[model samples]
Target chain A: MAHEEPINYYEYLRPNKKYPNVWCSGCGIGVVMGSLIRAIDRIGLDKNDVAVVSGIGCTGRMPVYMDFNTMHTTHGRALAFATGLKISRPKLHVIVVMGDGDAMAIGGNHFLHACRRNIDMTAIVVNNWIYGMTGGQYSPTTPLNARATTAPYGNVEQAMPICEVAAAAGASYVARTTVYHATEMDKFLEAAIRKHGFSVVETVSYCHTTFGRLNKRGGVVDMMRWLKDNSVGQIAAQKLDEEEKAAKIVRGVVCDVEKPEYLDLYQQVIDRAMEAK
Target chain B: MTETGSAENQAAQPVAPGTVSETPAKKKGPRGKVTVFGTWCKGCGICVAFCPTGVLSLDENGHPYVEFAEKCSACHWCDTHCPDLAIIVEPIE
Candidate 1:
């Protein structure tokens, strides 16, 4: 019966000499990690078949911690590498974990192309708005008038809508969830992975050290509180979209559709070649 | 009497074990023939350590290049946990 209880993440995580996690005490990355591991264990896929890639940022360090096929690629380039991996080996299931700056800024182009191509991969962007890894510099996803290390006087640029971008770029599946919605995160992640083409699951995270303190977001509790207070279902969020309702955050699967997958298409070419010569 | 997320009715379940990605594994064709990719590996042995079927091993640099091929269950632990993002899992067909 106890075995049925969710697997203990802390006990079985990839053994690291760095016992005390480096993230801020309330950082939700730990929770996200726990949920992901449990989901993978349940999916019945051989752990060996899964490749998790990450870009440079706080979240980039996540792959190093996970005991999976992982790569810590250059900042904002995790998707590009993952694209190569998925295309070169269409059989592989490649998932990319990236941060706001890495996925939405310098790596923006690759992210879009992956969606457009509908590459066989899943991208989980941990968006804390500001760049938490580089001491809270203003990022493209940083909200309008938010303070950052670079934006000492508050940011003038409006944050880009990542899920909208994903949808616009033709990601076959697009979902937005938050750390506060731990339950939803797991469900969305599972669905995203199962979806055959490019899937972008944006997980809004908390950055107490930089983004929270500099902006008015307060601490971890405040961030979680925002998630709870602003939570709305997909149906409800859709209604709001019609009525122009605006909440601090919305959580649900935004898009799920069938599209021509890049890797499978490449495999079709191989299939044809075998038949030809 | 039913197990939660126990490989049945997984869709309606609020949370199910998710598909682990990016490790290595072996797949048997209809005849059980297996092929392995030795390069594209960083030699990290998380796969060797996590294989529940006890089917994979490490060559040099801790990469999972050593394989007997026949004993493989195609469990995919090696494919899932290879730190270099190497390894591929597919049927030989």
Candidate 2:
């Protein structure tokens, strides 16, 4: 008789998918994907009822490896595609993944409206600061004075604070963490998925090959260590003065509140129309 | 698989034939078993750098070896943060 292989956590991955996933070695997007899988498993969610959507970029390729209802949509339109999916089948748990450029540049409008509409979906923006897929172009979140292929001298533009924008745009839940803080990332992701309305989890990652090499930041180990030394927790950030806080990446939940979801509100309108008829 | 000897030698040399390298180890451990699927690993070194108890270390070729499997806290940190999903920290019976 043949021996049985014990079930492993990696079963969440598609069985026939090729190994050594598409991301570059030590890319933090993989860590974010891992956190998402762990969060879904912990929630005991049925894979059949979950949908993973992504747009064009390095992070966009994630849904291809995941064993769920997955959609690899066009550039900067992941949330738009997710919106349609959520409206048509409100019961499905929709998760969208996008890179910094995909989310904040091309898809910026969709991102803001998704928050404003209070839709029930979880958006995980894996921000590596530079456009990793298209060969190190400057992204909206690239810190001021950072070097990219486009910004050879230095990036003159200020970086966009993703969590702040999400909160300001009216997302029900907004949280931020880095790839180095994997445990905290898992918790924040789980919370975002469970939240009732639009939620955003910005994972601050590093693009070692493109961004790091261009900037002369060290290898993957050094990049990972940088995340460890630079980031500050939300509460601890409060204690630090302006100068100290400015240098540290603030991590933790920025905002979370109960709100009426867009689909639920639309359903009430449908009921009212039916009554009138 | 279950690595039972000094970890330094294992890091310096490649895995010898006839040693459990392909399948998950069946050892019964108080903490758990740490399995590395060699083929799937990308030699990223994230697991090695972030392991809290110094349980993993990179080999000569950059792949991680279970340097101190006994020290693994079953924290699932290595497995969860692995970019390739190559490591599994399973609690053995």
Candidate 3:
């Protein structure tokens, strides 16, 4: 079968980087990074025109590999730095990458405020249910009964569904997809990148090295299969009864609505001040 | 009966050095080509494990290669899932 020229993913990646990324074998962070790169490529965005910011975690390391204007910020402060960057460089497409612990745990305040402010930026949260970089500690999104290094007897605390939190916090765009659903993740990421206001895309990922081994969840294949078997599209989820839906992760765009963006609204304030002068 | 026992043994045996039987060779199926950039591959086995069709397998060094090109469906799962960006899949012309 004749085919178009295959895309060289390395073109988007840093050329001088050594072989193999820092992520563990079968870690879902790579899949999410690939999807994000593909989405940016699809939109025809110039690498120079994009600013990728990340907090400290496995997810935080993503920007270091990309051939874009990147910044690795302090732990749980990616969005705060991204907000400042977006405000100063309104023309640049700011994308923030954060892990579950970075986004919803210590960074919870920044995450909520970023959503409530409705800034013109894209926030991609990789929810791996555990803090893989910090040695598989239980995170805010780690489900009840899930095993983590910090939660040896299984977590008694409830997990926070990030997409729902984003939606409730007034993000103009919110969606969720797993690494197993690569194509779907690409599409959702593309849409999230295109959204004008605060957009949050929660990528449910797996940390097979730490989380899987501790939980006895097998390897990469088993974890990917679990994601495939457990998640249901939002529309399909609505049709199911409460019990059926309870066990299934609802994927797809949870919320999307147009609203005046933060920076654009901020511009109005400047205009009023000028008029007063 | 002898064939059945041998087949079971083949299946049960751990992946050994220089063994090419990781993915069953399929003669009649959609064919594609998989290219692995050796320098980029981390021997993760993610692409091999997540492949919907058993078209990929890791060599002794843990680098992945297309073991059964004929079984490829051009799903691009391996291409997308490779953490190291080492693998690319394209339909054979």
Candidate 4:
């Protein structure tokens, strides 16, 4: 008997559709997106009850193609918009999508505050370092001295530690995964949705167009292999020195804590107001 | 697919690949230019092969560098995946 491959999430994607996935063939964003969809499926949420929100970037283009109640919002405000949407609806599965540039740079402030608030929402930040949409400009997540359009002389700025930022900002659940870690990513996203408060899933993704070109990284398959080998679990990652851990990717849930979500607190306020009336 | 539309449009467009296919609104600057930085040079040379403009060449240091800043289409193959953190595409601003 021939063995069958396990059911894949990519099957859910609309093949031969109008919205050509602007992402490159092996880009991690697609894998992350598929993992997210699988999370919703695993959680058994109705498609109508899920609202996928996104900011500007190639990752932000995701909501436009999804078959759910999605909103393609302004850059970096995806979490803020989803915050309001979740608080109002209370039953919706709100997911915010953002790219490295939109998440860690222009919309960076929003990201921190969302975690701090412990809002009842899920945030998926695809960190590919450079801005994939508007050519290759260096974003905050771009490694120091890495080349970008604005940083043609070489980026002197430090790359932000996204998972650390989320954990420090008080997110109840935080995790980091790469495009190459598909199984772990789906597992992480599934757990994030089950958590009570804010959750951040940082995906170390790839940009083969600009960052890849400038850096002379190999083709897509090679890029995936690089990500897989470089990644270490967050606990194992901590034991290594910064230089020893140089160019390494870190995956797995770094933080998971229990706290009342913002919506529940809002519900208490609403009940008090109703009693007064 | 009108026959008359073809002859009229051909005069308005350039015959070659780099030639103007459509009359763009911006005033013409120096043609296409690709800028690759040396610091990020893992030296894959995907840019040299992917350059439809055929303007990229390896520097003596073996990292891809472009001298003809005027002859690039800004396609960005060289700027995308330099594994060592070298190279970028920029207009001469």
Q: Best-fitting candidate, measured by lDDT? A: 2
RMSD of 1: 16.0
| Residues A1-277 of candidate 4: C-alpha lDDT, one tens digit per residue | 0001222333444445553355554466766776677678777787788899999999998876677888998888887788889878988888888998788888889888988889988888889989988999888899888888888889998989999999998999999988666667778899988888999989888888888888888676566667867889867889999986767877788789998778788789989999999
lDDT tens readout by residue for model 3, A1-277: 2124456687899978765888887688988888888889888899999999999999998998999999999999999999999988999999999999999998999999999999989999999999998798999998899999988999999999899999999999999998888889888889998999999999999989888999999988798889989999988998999999988888999899998999999999999999999
Tens digits of lDDT, candidate 2, B7-32: 75655454442132343444443455
Clash number for model 2?
Answer: 0
On residues A58-99, what C-alpha lDDT tens digit does candidate 1 reach at each position? 888777777778888998899988888877767777989988
Write down the TM-score of model 2's second chain. 0.66
Could you tell me the TM-score of candidate 4? Answer: 0.70
**RMSD of each predicted structure:** 16.0, 5.6, 4.2, 15.8
In model 2, pairs of residues that clash are none
TM-score, every prediction: 0.71, 0.89, 0.89, 0.70
Candidate 2 local lDDT, A34-100, one digit each (tens): 8888888777799999999999999999998999999999999999999999999999999999998
Pairing residues by index, what is the TM-score of model 3?
A: 0.89
What clash count goes with each model? Answer: 34, 0, 0, 29
Give, for candidate 1 chain A, the lowest lDDT window spanning 10 residues: A1-10
Evaluate residue A262 in candidate 3 and report its C-alpha lDDT on the 0 to 100 scale: 96
Candidate 3 lDDT tens digits, B1-93: 999999988755544322233365445555456777777777878777777787677777877766655567666777877777777777553
Error of 4 at B44 (Å): 17
**Residue-level error in angstroms, candidate 3, position B58:** 3.0
- Rank the candidate models, highest lDDT first: 2, 3, 4, 1
DockQ of all candidate complexes? 0.02, 0.36, 0.40, 0.02
